[model samples]
Target: MFEIERRLYDEGHRFVACIDEVGRGCLFGDVVACAIILPQRYTIDGVRDSKKLSPSKREKLNGYILHDSIAVGLGRITPAVIDRVNIKEATRLAMKQALDNLTDKDGKRIIPSYVLIDAERIQTDIPQLGVIDGDNIVHGISAASIVAKVFRDSLCISWDKAYSGYDIAGNKGYGTAKHIQALLEIGPAELHRKSFISKIMEGKK
Candidate 1:
Protein backbone atom coordinates (compact mmCIF):
# COMPACT_ATOMS: atom_id res chain seq x y z
CA MET A 1 0.00 0.00 0.00
CA PHE A 2 2.75 2.40 0.94
CA GLU A 3 4.69 1.45 -2.16
CA ILE A 4 1.91 2.66 -4.46
CA GLU A 5 1.75 6.08 -2.79
CA ARG A 6 5.54 6.21 -2.55
CA ARG A 7 5.77 5.81 -6.31
CA LEU A 8 3.48 8.79 -6.77
CA TYR A 9 5.62 10.82 -4.37
CA ASP A 10 8.76 9.89 -6.25
CA GLU A 11 7.13 11.16 -9.43
CA GLY A 12 6.99 14.66 -7.85
CA HIS A 13 3.35 14.82 -6.87
CA ARG A 14 3.84 16.65 -3.60
CA PHE A 15 0.24 16.61 -2.52
CA VAL A 16 -1.66 13.45 -3.44
CA ALA A 17 -5.17 13.28 -2.09
CA CYS A 18 -6.64 9.80 -1.55
CA ILE A 19 -10.42 9.90 -1.73
CA ASP A 20 -13.09 7.44 -0.54
CA GLU A 21 -16.77 7.51 0.35
CA VAL A 22 -19.23 5.89 2.80
CA GLY A 23 -23.02 5.37 3.11
CA ARG A 24 -23.58 4.95 -0.59
CA GLY A 25 -25.59 1.80 0.10
CA CYS A 26 -27.55 3.26 2.96
CA LEU A 27 -31.33 3.58 2.96
CA PHE A 28 -31.20 6.87 4.84
CA GLY A 29 -29.04 9.86 5.59
CA ASP A 30 -26.33 11.36 3.42
CA VAL A 31 -23.48 9.95 1.41
CA VAL A 32 -20.18 11.11 2.86
CA ALA A 33 -16.82 11.45 1.19
CA CYS A 34 -13.39 12.22 2.55
CA ALA A 35 -10.17 13.42 0.97
CA ILE A 36 -6.97 12.90 2.93
CA ILE A 37 -3.46 13.99 2.11
CA LEU A 38 -0.66 12.47 4.12
CA PRO A 39 2.95 13.64 4.30
CA GLN A 40 5.18 12.08 1.68
CA ARG A 41 6.10 8.49 2.63
CA TYR A 42 4.21 8.70 5.91
CA THR A 43 2.67 5.40 6.95
CA ILE A 44 0.37 4.69 9.88
CA ASP A 45 0.22 1.17 11.27
CA GLY A 46 -3.07 -0.83 11.29
CA VAL A 47 -4.82 1.52 8.88
CA ARG A 48 -7.13 -0.40 6.54
CA ASP A 49 -10.62 -0.20 5.08
CA SER A 50 -13.08 1.30 7.54
CA LYS A 51 -15.58 -1.50 6.92
CA LYS A 52 -13.09 -4.02 8.31
CA LEU A 53 -12.46 -2.12 11.54
CA SER A 54 -14.51 -2.05 14.74
CA PRO A 55 -16.23 1.21 15.66
CA SER A 56 -13.77 1.83 18.51
CA LYS A 57 -10.80 1.17 16.26
CA ARG A 58 -12.07 3.46 13.54
CA GLU A 59 -12.72 6.24 16.04
CA LYS A 60 -9.15 6.02 17.26
CA LEU A 61 -7.71 5.92 13.73
CA ASN A 62 -9.80 8.94 12.76
CA GLY A 63 -8.00 11.03 15.37
CA TYR A 64 -4.58 9.92 14.26
CA ILE A 65 -5.35 10.60 10.60
CA LEU A 66 -6.60 14.08 11.38
CA HIS A 67 -3.56 14.85 13.47
CA ASP A 68 -0.97 13.44 11.06
CA SER A 69 -2.49 14.35 7.71
CA ILE A 70 -1.17 17.26 5.67
CA ALA A 71 -4.74 18.15 4.74
CA VAL A 72 -8.14 16.53 5.30
CA GLY A 73 -11.58 17.51 4.06
CA LEU A 74 -15.05 15.99 4.23
CA GLY A 75 -18.19 16.25 2.09
CA ARG A 76 -21.77 15.11 2.58
CA ILE A 77 -24.82 14.99 0.30
CA THR A 78 -28.27 14.93 1.84
CA PRO A 79 -30.99 12.41 1.01
CA ALA A 80 -32.76 15.11 -0.98
CA VAL A 81 -29.74 15.63 -3.17
CA ILE A 82 -29.25 11.91 -3.61
CA ASP A 83 -32.87 11.55 -4.76
CA ARG A 84 -32.63 14.58 -7.04
CA VAL A 85 -29.39 13.73 -8.85
CA ASN A 86 -29.25 9.99 -8.14
CA ILE A 87 -26.64 8.33 -5.92
CA LYS A 88 -23.75 8.07 -8.41
CA GLU A 89 -23.77 11.74 -9.31
CA ALA A 90 -24.40 12.68 -5.71
CA THR A 91 -21.30 10.71 -4.72
CA ARG A 92 -19.19 12.49 -7.33
CA LEU A 93 -20.54 15.83 -6.20
CA ALA A 94 -19.57 15.00 -2.62
CA MET A 95 -16.09 14.07 -3.77
CA LYS A 96 -15.74 17.42 -5.57
CA GLN A 97 -16.93 19.17 -2.45
CA ALA A 98 -14.36 17.32 -0.37
CA LEU A 99 -11.60 18.38 -2.71
CA ASP A 100 -12.87 21.96 -2.63
CA ASN A 101 -12.79 21.96 1.16
CA LEU A 102 -9.07 21.16 1.34
CA THR A 103 -7.24 24.12 2.84
CA ASP A 104 -4.63 25.12 5.38
CA LYS A 105 -5.21 26.88 8.71
CA ASP A 106 -4.55 30.19 6.91
CA GLY A 107 -7.52 29.31 4.64
CA LYS A 108 -5.40 29.03 1.54
CA ARG A 109 -6.70 26.21 -0.66
CA ILE A 110 -4.43 23.16 -0.68
CA ILE A 111 -5.06 21.62 -4.07
CA PRO A 112 -3.68 18.18 -4.75
CA SER A 113 -1.35 17.75 -7.68
CA TYR A 114 -2.73 14.22 -8.03
CA VAL A 115 -5.81 12.38 -6.78
CA LEU A 116 -6.36 8.69 -6.05
CA ILE A 117 -10.01 7.77 -5.89
CA ASP A 118 -11.59 4.49 -4.88
CA ALA A 119 -13.29 3.04 -7.96
CA GLU A 120 -14.91 6.25 -9.08
CA ARG A 121 -13.91 8.54 -11.91
CA ILE A 122 -14.44 12.16 -10.92
CA GLN A 123 -14.47 15.13 -13.21
CA THR A 124 -11.63 17.34 -12.05
CA ASP A 125 -8.94 19.38 -13.73
CA ILE A 126 -6.36 17.89 -11.42
CA PRO A 127 -5.06 14.51 -12.52
CA GLN A 128 -6.76 11.53 -10.81
CA LEU A 129 -6.61 7.75 -10.84
CA GLY A 130 -9.40 5.40 -9.82
CA VAL A 131 -8.33 2.16 -8.21
CA ILE A 132 -10.75 -0.68 -7.47
CA ASP A 133 -10.78 -1.73 -3.80
CA GLY A 134 -8.27 1.00 -3.14
CA ASP A 135 -9.45 1.47 0.41
CA ASN A 136 -8.53 -2.09 1.28
CA ILE A 137 -4.99 -1.80 -0.11
CA VAL A 138 -4.08 1.89 -0.20
CA HIS A 139 -3.08 3.51 3.08
CA GLY A 140 -4.26 6.99 2.20
CA ILE A 141 -7.62 5.78 0.83
CA SER A 142 -8.07 3.70 3.97
CA ALA A 143 -7.48 6.78 6.10
CA ALA A 144 -10.08 8.71 4.11
CA SER A 145 -12.50 5.79 4.45
CA ILE A 146 -12.06 5.82 8.21
CA VAL A 147 -12.81 9.53 8.38
CA ALA A 148 -15.94 9.22 6.27
CA LYS A 149 -17.20 6.19 8.17
CA VAL A 150 -16.60 7.69 11.59
CA PHE A 151 -18.15 11.03 10.67
CA ARG A 152 -21.24 9.46 9.14
CA ASP A 153 -21.61 7.01 12.00
CA SER A 154 -21.57 9.91 14.45
CA LEU A 155 -24.37 11.59 12.50
CA CYS A 156 -26.41 8.39 12.59
CA ILE A 157 -25.97 8.23 16.35
CA SER A 158 -27.48 11.68 16.68
CA TRP A 159 -30.32 10.84 14.31
CA ASP A 160 -31.05 7.70 16.28
CA LYS A 161 -32.13 9.86 19.22
CA ALA A 162 -35.01 11.42 17.29
CA TYR A 163 -35.90 8.32 15.27
CA SER A 164 -35.71 5.49 17.73
CA GLY A 165 -36.96 2.20 16.33
CA TYR A 166 -35.04 2.09 13.08
CA ASP A 167 -31.76 1.55 14.89
CA ILE A 168 -30.09 4.16 12.74
CA ALA A 169 -27.11 4.29 15.05
CA GLY A 170 -26.60 0.54 15.14
CA ASN A 171 -27.09 -0.07 11.44
CA LYS A 172 -25.76 3.27 10.24
CA GLY A 173 -28.73 3.64 7.86
CA TYR A 174 -28.17 0.38 5.99
CA GLY A 175 -31.34 -1.54 5.19
CA THR A 176 -30.86 -4.33 7.67
CA ALA A 177 -33.78 -6.63 8.50
CA LYS A 178 -34.53 -4.67 11.66
CA HIS A 179 -34.44 -1.38 9.80
CA ILE A 180 -36.74 -2.69 7.07
CA GLN A 181 -39.21 -3.98 9.67
CA ALA A 182 -39.32 -0.55 11.28
CA LEU A 183 -39.89 1.09 7.92
CA LEU A 184 -42.76 -1.30 7.24
CA GLU A 185 -44.32 -0.72 10.63
CA ILE A 186 -44.01 3.04 10.73
CA GLY A 187 -43.59 3.99 7.09
CA PRO A 188 -40.67 6.17 6.05
CA ALA A 189 -39.25 8.87 8.26
CA GLU A 190 -38.19 12.28 6.97
CA LEU A 191 -34.59 11.10 6.90
CA HIS A 192 -35.30 7.89 5.02
CA ARG A 193 -34.52 7.92 1.32
CA LYS A 194 -37.98 7.60 -0.18
CA SER A 195 -36.85 6.21 -3.47
CA PHE A 196 -34.82 3.49 -1.85
CA ILE A 197 -37.67 2.34 0.34
CA SER A 198 -40.31 2.50 -2.37
CA LYS A 199 -39.58 -0.95 -3.72
CA ILE A 200 -39.59 -2.44 -0.28
CA MET A 201 -42.90 -0.75 0.46
CA GLU A 202 -44.28 -2.10 -2.77
CA GLY A 203 -43.36 -5.60 -1.74
CA LYS A 204 -45.14 -5.20 1.57
CA LYS A 205 -48.33 -3.95 -0.03
Candidate 2:
Protein backbone atom coordinates (compact mmCIF):
# COMPACT_ATOMS: atom_id res chain seq x y z
CA MET A 1 0.00 0.00 0.00
CA PHE A 2 2.95 2.25 0.47
CA GLU A 3 4.14 4.10 -2.66
CA ILE A 4 0.92 3.17 -4.42
CA GLU A 5 -0.85 6.54 -4.22
CA ARG A 6 1.08 7.67 -7.26
CA ARG A 7 -0.84 5.02 -9.21
CA LEU A 8 -3.98 6.94 -8.28
CA TYR A 9 -2.65 10.10 -9.94
CA ASP A 10 -0.48 8.91 -12.81
CA GLU A 11 -2.95 6.29 -13.93
CA GLY A 12 -5.64 9.03 -13.82
CA HIS A 13 -7.71 7.05 -11.34
CA ARG A 14 -8.22 7.60 -7.62
CA PHE A 15 -8.43 3.93 -6.61
CA VAL A 16 -6.11 1.42 -8.21
CA ALA A 17 -5.76 -2.32 -7.77
CA CYS A 18 -2.99 -4.46 -9.27
CA ILE A 19 -2.85 -7.87 -10.90
CA ASP A 20 0.03 -10.19 -11.79
CA GLU A 21 0.88 -13.81 -12.71
CA VAL A 22 3.73 -16.25 -12.32
CA GLY A 23 4.97 -19.58 -13.81
CA ARG A 24 4.43 -18.87 -17.48
CA GLY A 25 7.75 -20.44 -18.38
CA CYS A 26 7.59 -23.43 -16.10
CA LEU A 27 7.30 -26.69 -17.98
CA PHE A 28 5.79 -28.73 -15.17
CA GLY A 29 3.58 -26.41 -13.17
CA ASP A 30 0.39 -24.41 -13.23
CA VAL A 31 0.35 -20.71 -14.01
CA VAL A 32 -0.82 -18.69 -11.04
CA ALA A 33 -2.24 -15.20 -10.76
CA CYS A 34 -3.07 -13.05 -7.80
CA ALA A 35 -5.26 -9.98 -7.61
CA ILE A 36 -4.84 -7.84 -4.54
CA ILE A 37 -6.34 -4.65 -3.18
CA LEU A 38 -4.82 -3.12 -0.12
CA PRO A 39 -5.94 -0.43 2.30
CA GLN A 40 -4.52 2.98 1.53
CA ARG A 41 -2.57 2.95 4.76
CA TYR A 42 -1.44 -0.66 4.56
CA THR A 43 2.28 -1.25 4.64
CA ILE A 44 4.34 -4.42 4.46
CA ASP A 45 8.01 -3.84 5.12
CA GLY A 46 10.54 -5.29 2.65
CA VAL A 47 7.90 -6.05 0.08
CA ARG A 48 9.23 -6.18 -3.47
CA ASP A 49 9.11 -8.32 -6.58
CA SER A 50 8.90 -11.97 -5.55
CA LYS A 51 11.99 -12.65 -7.64
CA LYS A 52 13.85 -10.30 -5.33
CA LEU A 53 12.77 -11.94 -2.12
CA SER A 54 13.93 -15.13 -0.47
CA PRO A 55 11.56 -18.08 -0.20
CA SER A 56 11.05 -17.46 3.49
CA LYS A 57 10.21 -13.80 2.89
CA ARG A 58 7.73 -14.67 0.18
CA GLU A 59 6.16 -17.31 2.41
CA LYS A 60 5.85 -14.74 5.18
CA LEU A 61 4.21 -12.26 2.82
CA ASN A 62 1.84 -15.00 1.69
CA GLY A 63 0.59 -15.23 5.27
CA TYR A 64 0.62 -11.49 5.75
CA ILE A 65 -1.45 -10.91 2.62
CA LEU A 66 -3.93 -13.53 3.68
CA HIS A 67 -4.30 -11.79 7.03
CA ASP A 68 -3.91 -8.07 6.18
CA SER A 69 -5.35 -7.39 2.77
CA ILE A 70 -8.57 -5.61 1.94
CA ALA A 71 -9.17 -8.11 -0.84
CA VAL A 72 -7.11 -10.99 -2.22
CA GLY A 73 -7.84 -13.81 -4.62
CA LEU A 74 -5.68 -16.40 -6.32
CA GLY A 75 -6.30 -18.22 -9.57
CA ARG A 76 -4.40 -20.94 -11.34
CA ILE A 77 -4.54 -22.29 -14.90
CA THR A 78 -3.43 -25.89 -15.14
CA PRO A 79 -0.80 -27.33 -17.48
CA ALA A 80 -3.37 -28.97 -19.74
CA VAL A 81 -5.17 -25.66 -20.18
CA ILE A 82 -1.89 -23.92 -20.78
CA ASP A 83 -1.09 -26.39 -23.53
CA ARG A 84 -4.50 -26.02 -25.10
CA VAL A 85 -4.98 -22.24 -24.96
CA ASN A 86 -1.25 -21.47 -24.98
CA ILE A 87 0.56 -19.49 -22.32
CA LYS A 88 -0.46 -15.88 -23.04
CA GLU A 89 -4.17 -16.45 -23.18
CA ALA A 90 -4.07 -18.82 -20.24
CA THR A 91 -2.20 -16.18 -18.24
CA ARG A 92 -4.85 -13.56 -18.96
CA LEU A 93 -7.64 -15.99 -18.18
CA ALA A 94 -6.00 -16.80 -14.87
CA MET A 95 -5.75 -13.10 -14.10
CA LYS A 96 -9.41 -12.66 -14.87
CA GLN A 97 -10.19 -15.59 -12.64
CA ALA A 98 -8.37 -13.87 -9.82
CA LEU A 99 -10.17 -10.63 -10.54
CA ASP A 100 -13.52 -12.34 -10.66
CA ASN A 101 -12.94 -13.75 -7.22
CA LEU A 102 -12.30 -10.36 -5.61
CA THR A 103 -14.86 -8.16 -3.83
CA ASP A 104 -14.97 -4.73 -2.29
CA LYS A 105 -15.98 -3.83 1.28
CA ASP A 106 -19.68 -4.29 0.64
CA GLY A 107 -19.57 -8.06 0.06
CA LYS A 108 -20.46 -7.50 -3.59
CA ARG A 109 -18.19 -8.01 -6.57
CA ILE A 110 -16.85 -4.75 -7.98
CA ILE A 111 -14.50 -3.91 -10.79
CA PRO A 112 -11.33 -2.39 -9.55
CA SER A 113 -11.88 1.37 -9.48
CA TYR A 114 -8.67 1.21 -11.54
CA VAL A 115 -6.26 -1.64 -12.26
CA LEU A 116 -2.53 -1.85 -12.90
CA ILE A 117 -0.80 -4.81 -14.51
CA ASP A 118 2.80 -5.78 -15.24
CA ALA A 119 2.37 -6.67 -18.86
CA GLU A 120 -0.23 -6.82 -21.67
CA ARG A 121 -3.60 -5.24 -21.07
CA ILE A 122 -6.58 -7.54 -20.66
CA GLN A 123 -9.75 -6.63 -22.56
CA THR A 124 -11.99 -6.57 -19.55
CA ASP A 125 -14.80 -4.18 -18.69
CA ILE A 126 -12.74 -2.80 -15.83
CA PRO A 127 -10.58 0.29 -16.29
CA GLN A 128 -7.00 -0.98 -16.46
CA LEU A 129 -3.48 0.29 -17.12
CA GLY A 130 -0.47 -1.73 -18.17
CA VAL A 131 2.93 -0.80 -16.81
CA ILE A 132 5.98 -2.58 -18.16
CA ASP A 133 7.59 -2.97 -14.74
CA GLY A 134 4.41 -2.65 -12.74
CA ASP A 135 5.20 -5.32 -10.21
CA ASN A 136 8.04 -3.28 -8.76
CA ILE A 137 6.38 0.08 -9.31
CA VAL A 138 2.96 -0.65 -7.87
CA HIS A 139 2.78 -2.02 -4.38
CA GLY A 140 -0.41 -3.98 -4.91
CA ILE A 141 0.97 -5.48 -8.11
CA SER A 142 4.19 -6.28 -6.31
CA ALA A 143 2.29 -8.02 -3.56
CA ALA A 144 0.30 -10.07 -6.03
CA SER A 145 3.45 -10.91 -7.92
CA ILE A 146 5.01 -12.06 -4.71
CA VAL A 147 2.10 -14.28 -3.82
CA ALA A 148 1.64 -15.79 -7.27
CA LYS A 149 5.32 -16.40 -7.73
CA VAL A 150 5.85 -18.04 -4.39
CA PHE A 151 2.83 -20.24 -4.81
CA ARG A 152 3.75 -21.36 -8.32
CA ASP A 153 7.43 -21.84 -7.60
CA SER A 154 6.70 -23.97 -4.57
CA LEU A 155 4.55 -26.20 -6.74
CA CYS A 156 7.33 -26.53 -9.28
CA ILE A 157 9.82 -27.52 -6.62
CA SER A 158 7.43 -30.08 -5.25
CA TRP A 159 6.82 -31.42 -8.74
CA ASP A 160 10.52 -31.96 -9.20
CA LYS A 161 10.25 -35.10 -7.13
CA ALA A 162 7.39 -36.48 -9.18
CA TYR A 163 9.15 -35.83 -12.51
CA SER A 164 12.83 -36.11 -11.95
CA GLY A 165 14.67 -36.12 -15.27
CA TYR A 166 14.25 -32.55 -16.46
CA ASP A 167 15.89 -31.01 -13.42
CA ILE A 168 12.72 -29.11 -12.65
CA ALA A 169 14.00 -27.94 -9.34
CA GLY A 170 16.94 -26.09 -10.90
CA ASN A 171 15.30 -24.76 -14.06
CA LYS A 172 11.69 -24.54 -12.92
CA GLY A 173 10.77 -25.96 -16.30
CA TYR A 174 11.89 -23.06 -18.46
CA GLY A 175 13.12 -24.30 -21.79
CA THR A 176 16.70 -23.61 -21.04
CA ALA A 177 19.33 -24.88 -23.45
CA LYS A 178 20.04 -27.70 -21.07
CA HIS A 179 16.39 -28.44 -20.61
CA ILE A 180 15.89 -28.61 -24.35
CA GLN A 181 18.92 -30.82 -24.70
CA ALA A 182 17.57 -33.09 -22.03
CA LEU A 183 14.23 -33.19 -23.75
CA LEU A 184 15.93 -34.23 -26.97
CA GLU A 185 17.93 -36.86 -25.19
CA ILE A 186 14.97 -38.43 -23.47
CA GLY A 187 12.01 -37.09 -25.42
CA PRO A 188 9.37 -35.08 -23.58
CA ALA A 189 8.13 -36.33 -20.28
CA GLU A 190 4.52 -35.75 -19.33
CA LEU A 191 5.56 -32.57 -17.61
CA HIS A 192 6.95 -30.73 -20.62
CA ARG A 193 4.75 -28.18 -22.40
CA LYS A 194 5.11 -30.32 -25.50
CA SER A 195 3.41 -27.85 -27.76
CA PHE A 196 5.65 -24.95 -26.90
CA ILE A 197 8.84 -26.95 -26.96
CA SER A 198 7.64 -29.07 -29.82
CA LYS A 199 7.03 -25.97 -31.88
CA ILE A 200 10.69 -25.16 -31.68
CA MET A 201 11.57 -28.56 -33.07
CA GLU A 202 8.43 -29.39 -35.01
CA GLY A 203 7.68 -32.35 -32.76
CA LYS A 204 11.32 -33.25 -33.24
CA LYS A 205 10.66 -34.43 -36.75
Candidate 3:
Protein backbone atom coordinates (compact mmCIF):
# COMPACT_ATOMS: atom_id res chain seq x y z
CA MET A 1 0.00 0.00 0.00
CA PHE A 2 2.92 2.28 0.67
CA GLU A 3 4.53 1.66 -2.72
CA ILE A 4 2.71 4.51 -4.43
CA GLU A 5 3.39 6.97 -1.65
CA ARG A 6 7.01 5.94 -1.41
CA ARG A 7 7.47 6.29 -5.14
CA LEU A 8 5.86 9.71 -5.11
CA TYR A 9 7.94 10.77 -2.15
CA ASP A 10 11.07 9.73 -3.99
CA GLU A 11 9.89 11.89 -6.87
CA GLY A 12 9.84 14.90 -4.46
CA HIS A 13 6.08 15.16 -3.81
CA ARG A 14 5.85 15.79 -0.07
CA PHE A 15 2.15 16.37 0.46
CA VAL A 16 0.24 14.00 -1.78
CA ALA A 17 -3.47 14.23 -1.20
CA CYS A 18 -5.23 10.89 -1.68
CA ILE A 19 -8.93 11.16 -2.43
CA ASP A 20 -11.94 8.83 -2.59
CA GLU A 21 -15.73 9.02 -2.27
CA VAL A 22 -18.47 6.85 -0.76
CA GLY A 23 -22.24 6.53 -1.38
CA ARG A 24 -21.96 7.03 -5.13
CA GLY A 25 -24.15 4.00 -5.85
CA CYS A 26 -26.71 4.76 -3.17
CA LEU A 27 -30.31 5.53 -3.99
CA PHE A 28 -30.56 8.16 -1.25
CA GLY A 29 -28.59 10.94 0.45
CA ASP A 30 -25.54 12.88 -0.65
CA VAL A 31 -22.40 11.49 -2.21
CA VAL A 32 -19.54 12.10 0.25
CA ALA A 33 -15.93 12.56 -0.73
CA CYS A 34 -12.74 12.71 1.36
CA ALA A 35 -9.32 14.06 0.62
CA ILE A 36 -6.55 13.20 3.10
CA ILE A 37 -2.86 13.91 3.23
CA LEU A 38 -0.81 11.52 5.29
CA PRO A 39 2.77 12.22 6.21
CA GLN A 40 5.15 10.95 3.56
CA ARG A 41 5.77 7.19 3.76
CA TYR A 42 3.27 6.84 6.60
CA THR A 43 1.80 3.40 7.11
CA ILE A 44 -1.08 2.23 9.24
CA ASP A 45 -1.72 -1.43 9.84
CA GLY A 46 -5.14 -2.87 8.89
CA VAL A 47 -5.93 -0.05 6.46
CA ARG A 48 -7.51 -1.31 3.24
CA ASP A 49 -10.59 -0.76 1.12
CA SER A 50 -13.54 0.47 3.17
CA LYS A 51 -15.92 -1.97 1.43
CA LYS A 52 -13.76 -4.85 2.63
CA LEU A 53 -14.05 -3.90 6.28
CA SER A 54 -16.90 -4.22 8.74
CA PRO A 55 -18.51 -1.06 10.09
CA SER A 56 -16.83 -1.39 13.47
CA LYS A 57 -13.45 -1.93 11.85
CA ARG A 58 -13.88 1.01 9.55
CA GLU A 59 -14.85 3.22 12.45
CA LYS A 60 -11.80 2.15 14.39
CA LEU A 61 -9.49 2.93 11.50
CA ASN A 62 -11.22 6.20 10.78
CA GLY A 63 -10.24 7.56 14.20
CA TYR A 64 -6.63 6.57 13.72
CA ILE A 65 -6.48 7.95 10.18
CA LEU A 66 -7.91 11.27 11.16
CA HIS A 67 -5.55 11.61 14.10
CA ASP A 68 -2.50 10.85 12.00
CA SER A 69 -3.32 12.69 8.81
CA ILE A 70 -1.58 15.98 8.09
CA ALA A 71 -4.77 17.34 6.56
CA VAL A 72 -8.32 16.17 5.95
CA GLY A 73 -11.20 17.54 3.91
CA LEU A 74 -14.70 16.38 3.09
CA GLY A 75 -17.26 17.29 0.43
CA ARG A 76 -20.90 16.41 0.03
CA ILE A 77 -23.14 16.68 -3.04
CA THR A 78 -26.88 16.61 -2.44
CA PRO A 79 -29.39 14.37 -4.23
CA ALA A 80 -30.89 17.38 -6.01
CA VAL A 81 -27.50 18.28 -7.39
CA ILE A 82 -26.88 14.68 -8.36
CA ASP A 83 -30.10 14.74 -10.35
CA ARG A 84 -29.16 17.99 -12.03
CA VAL A 85 -25.61 17.07 -13.12
CA ASN A 86 -25.60 13.25 -13.09
CA ILE A 87 -23.65 10.99 -10.73
CA LYS A 88 -20.40 11.03 -12.70
CA GLU A 89 -20.30 14.80 -12.82
CA ALA A 90 -21.53 15.12 -9.24
CA THR A 91 -18.78 12.78 -8.09
CA ARG A 92 -16.15 14.86 -9.81
CA LEU A 93 -17.53 17.99 -8.23
CA ALA A 94 -17.49 16.36 -4.81
CA MET A 95 -13.89 15.28 -5.18
CA LYS A 96 -12.85 18.74 -6.30
CA GLN A 97 -14.71 20.25 -3.37
CA ALA A 98 -12.85 17.98 -1.00
CA LEU A 99 -9.56 19.14 -2.42
CA ASP A 100 -10.54 22.75 -2.23
CA ASN A 101 -11.57 22.31 1.40
CA LEU A 102 -8.37 20.67 2.59
CA THR A 103 -7.07 22.01 5.91
CA ASP A 104 -4.61 21.00 8.58
CA LYS A 105 -5.35 20.25 12.22
CA ASP A 106 -5.17 23.94 13.02
CA GLY A 107 -7.74 24.68 10.29
CA LYS A 108 -5.24 26.41 8.06
CA ARG A 109 -5.42 25.48 4.38
CA ILE A 110 -2.89 23.01 3.03
CA ILE A 111 -2.18 22.68 -0.66
CA PRO A 112 -1.09 19.27 -1.77
CA SER A 113 1.97 18.80 -3.93
CA TYR A 114 0.10 16.10 -5.86
CA VAL A 115 -3.19 14.28 -5.75
CA LEU A 116 -3.93 10.59 -6.12
CA ILE A 117 -7.59 9.90 -6.65
CA ASP A 118 -9.50 6.68 -6.92
CA ALA A 119 -10.60 5.94 -10.49
CA GLU A 120 -11.51 9.48 -11.53
CA ARG A 121 -9.73 12.69 -12.44
CA ILE A 122 -11.01 16.18 -11.71
CA GLN A 123 -10.40 19.68 -13.01
CA THR A 124 -7.53 20.76 -10.78
CA ASP A 125 -4.27 22.48 -11.54
CA ILE A 126 -2.55 20.28 -8.95
CA PRO A 127 -0.62 17.37 -10.48
CA GLN A 128 -2.78 14.28 -10.05
CA LEU A 129 -3.09 10.64 -11.06
CA GLY A 130 -6.25 8.57 -11.02
CA VAL A 131 -5.45 5.04 -9.91
CA ILE A 132 -7.79 2.16 -10.66
CA ASP A 133 -8.70 0.34 -7.41
CA GLY A 134 -6.63 2.83 -5.47
CA ASP A 135 -8.58 2.30 -2.26
CA ASN A 136 -7.27 -1.25 -2.09
CA ILE A 137 -3.84 -0.48 -3.46
CA VAL A 138 -2.87 2.88 -2.01
CA HIS A 139 -2.42 3.66 1.65
CA GLY A 140 -3.59 7.25 1.63
CA ILE A 141 -6.53 6.51 -0.65
CA SER A 142 -7.59 3.62 1.55
CA ALA A 143 -7.50 5.89 4.59
CA ALA A 144 -9.62 8.43 2.74
CA SER A 145 -12.10 5.69 1.81
CA ILE A 146 -12.47 4.70 5.44
CA VAL A 147 -13.01 8.31 6.47
CA ALA A 148 -15.60 8.92 3.76
CA LYS A 149 -17.43 5.66 4.46
CA VAL A 150 -17.61 6.22 8.20
CA PHE A 151 -18.71 9.82 7.76
CA ARG A 152 -21.50 8.90 5.34
CA ASP A 153 -22.62 6.01 7.52
CA SER A 154 -22.99 8.36 10.46
CA LEU A 155 -25.26 10.52 8.32
CA CYS A 156 -27.38 7.48 7.59
CA ILE A 157 -28.30 7.25 11.26
CA SER A 158 -29.60 10.82 11.25
CA TRP A 159 -31.37 10.28 7.94
CA ASP A 160 -33.09 7.18 9.28
CA LYS A 161 -34.59 9.23 12.08
CA ALA A 162 -35.46 12.20 9.89
CA TYR A 163 -36.96 10.23 6.99
CA SER A 164 -38.19 7.12 8.85
CA GLY A 165 -39.46 3.76 7.49
CA TYR A 166 -36.91 3.50 4.70
CA ASP A 167 -34.27 1.61 6.72
CA ILE A 168 -31.70 4.18 5.72
CA ALA A 169 -29.57 3.28 8.73
CA GLY A 170 -29.49 -0.42 7.97
CA ASN A 171 -29.08 -0.14 4.21
CA LYS A 172 -26.90 2.97 4.39
CA GLY A 173 -28.86 4.44 1.47
CA TYR A 174 -28.18 1.50 -0.85
CA GLY A 175 -31.02 0.25 -3.01
CA THR A 176 -32.02 -2.75 -0.95
CA ALA A 177 -35.25 -4.70 -1.39
CA LYS A 178 -36.78 -3.34 1.83
CA HIS A 179 -35.70 0.19 1.03
CA ILE A 180 -37.17 -0.06 -2.44
CA GLN A 181 -40.41 -1.47 -1.06
CA ALA A 182 -40.67 1.42 1.34
CA LEU A 183 -40.05 3.85 -1.50
CA LEU A 184 -42.96 2.31 -3.40
CA GLU A 185 -45.25 2.33 -0.40
CA ILE A 186 -44.48 5.59 1.44
CA GLY A 187 -42.68 7.34 -1.40
CA PRO A 188 -39.24 8.94 -1.45
CA ALA A 189 -38.12 11.45 1.13
CA GLU A 190 -36.46 14.71 0.15
CA LEU A 191 -33.06 13.06 0.41
CA HIS A 192 -33.81 10.27 -2.07
CA ARG A 193 -32.14 10.63 -5.43
CA LYS A 194 -35.01 11.25 -7.86
CA SER A 195 -33.01 10.39 -10.95
CA PHE A 196 -31.87 7.08 -9.54
CA ILE A 197 -35.31 6.08 -8.27
CA SER A 198 -37.44 6.96 -11.31
CA LYS A 199 -37.28 3.43 -12.62
CA ILE A 200 -38.11 2.01 -9.19
CA MET A 201 -41.05 4.37 -8.95
CA GLU A 202 -42.21 3.38 -12.44
CA GLY A 203 -42.09 -0.28 -11.46
CA LYS A 204 -44.54 0.40 -8.65
CA LYS A 205 -47.07 1.85 -11.12
Per-candidate TM-score against the hidden true structure: 0.96, 0.80, 0.99
Give lDDT for model 2.
Answer: 0.78
lDDT tens digits, residue span 58-90, model 1: 999899989888888889999999998999999
Model 3: per-residue Cα lDDT over 1-205, one tens digit each: 6788899899998899999999999999999999999988888899999999999999899999999999999999999999999999999999999999999999999999899999999999999999999998999999999999999999999999999999999999999999999999999999999999999999888
Q: Score each candidate by Cα lDDT.
A: 0.91, 0.78, 0.95
In terms of lDDT, model 3 sits at: 0.95
lDDT of 1 at 153: 93
TM-score of 2: 0.80
Question: Over the full model, what C-alpha lDDT does candidate 1 score relative to the true structure?
Answer: 0.91
Question: Candidate 1 deviates by what RMSD?
Answer: 1.1
- What TM value does model 3 have? 0.99
What would the per-residue lDDT of candidate 2 be over residues 151-171, giving only the tens digit for each residue? 777777888888877788788
Model 1 compared with the native: what TM-score? 0.96
